[model samples]
Target: MFVAAALALLATMILTIVRALSGPTLYDRLLAANSFGTKIVLFIAVYGFLAGRPDFLDIALVYTLINFVGTVAVLKFYEYDDSVGGDYQEDDY
Candidate 1:
């Protein structure tokens, strides 16, 4: 059962990657990326349980926090369209 759940999560992660690549808009891509991150957290936790390693849950939690922060930072950068005192503009990229 655990193996089946892991396989399903892996399949969803693949679909999420496809959506991120082919999204019609920036927001759609970002949403897909966020969803992908979430799936990763779930996958980690489930795998940890299946492997009987409780320590892996801590690693998954840390990853989840990092993912949330990284996503917020990216969204903020896009919202501002500039970084480092307006010296760096989005179009510059």
Candidate 2:
């Protein structure tokens, strides 16, 4: 059962990779990348369970946090056209 699930996840991951490569717009590509990261987390959890390694769950959790932060950062950067933060305007006294 776990083997079958892992295989399914692998297939989905492949599809996500294709979408990420051929997405029409930046948002589409970003969404695909986020989806791929989610699938990876699931795959890691399943594989860890199948392998009887409990530590993999912790790794997956960390990956999930990173994925969330990265997606938000990318979106923010695109939205504001700034990697650091909002536009900066020098004060005129």
Candidate 3:
């Protein structure tokens, strides 16, 4: 069962990578990237369980946090056009 799940997750991860590469807009690509990250976490957990390595779950959890933070940071950068902690001009509109 776990093997099947890992295989399915791998397939979906491939599809997600394709979407991220060919997405029409920035948001689409970002969403695909986020989805890929989530699938990776699942794959890690599944693989760890199948292999009887409990430590992979810890790695997966850490990756999950990183994914969430990275997505948020990217969105912030897009919104502000500045990720370097520099000042941003206020839109006159």
lDDT of 1 by residue, 1-93 (tens): 888989999999999999999987676788899889999999998898778885788888888899899899988887786443334345755
Q: All predictions: root-mean-square deviation over Cα?
A: 5.8, 7.5, 5.4
Over 1-93, each residue of candidate 3 has an lDDT whose tens digit, in order, gives: 999999999999999999999987676788999999999999999999889886779899999999999999998887786554333335522
Model 2 scores a TM of 0.84
Backbone clashes, each candidate: 0, 0, 0
For every model shown, what is its TM-score relative to the native structure? Answer: 0.82, 0.84, 0.83
Off by over 4 Å in 3: 82-93
**Candidate 3 lDDT for residue 8:** 96
Q: State the displacement of the C-alpha of residue 11, model 2, in Å, after optimal TM-score superposition.
A: 0.5
**Distance from true location, Cα of 2 in model 2, Å:** 0.6
Per-residue lDDT, model 2, residue 50, is 79
* lDDT (10s digit) by residue, model 2, range 4-89: 99999999999999999998666668899999999999999999977888588999999999999999989888767744433433
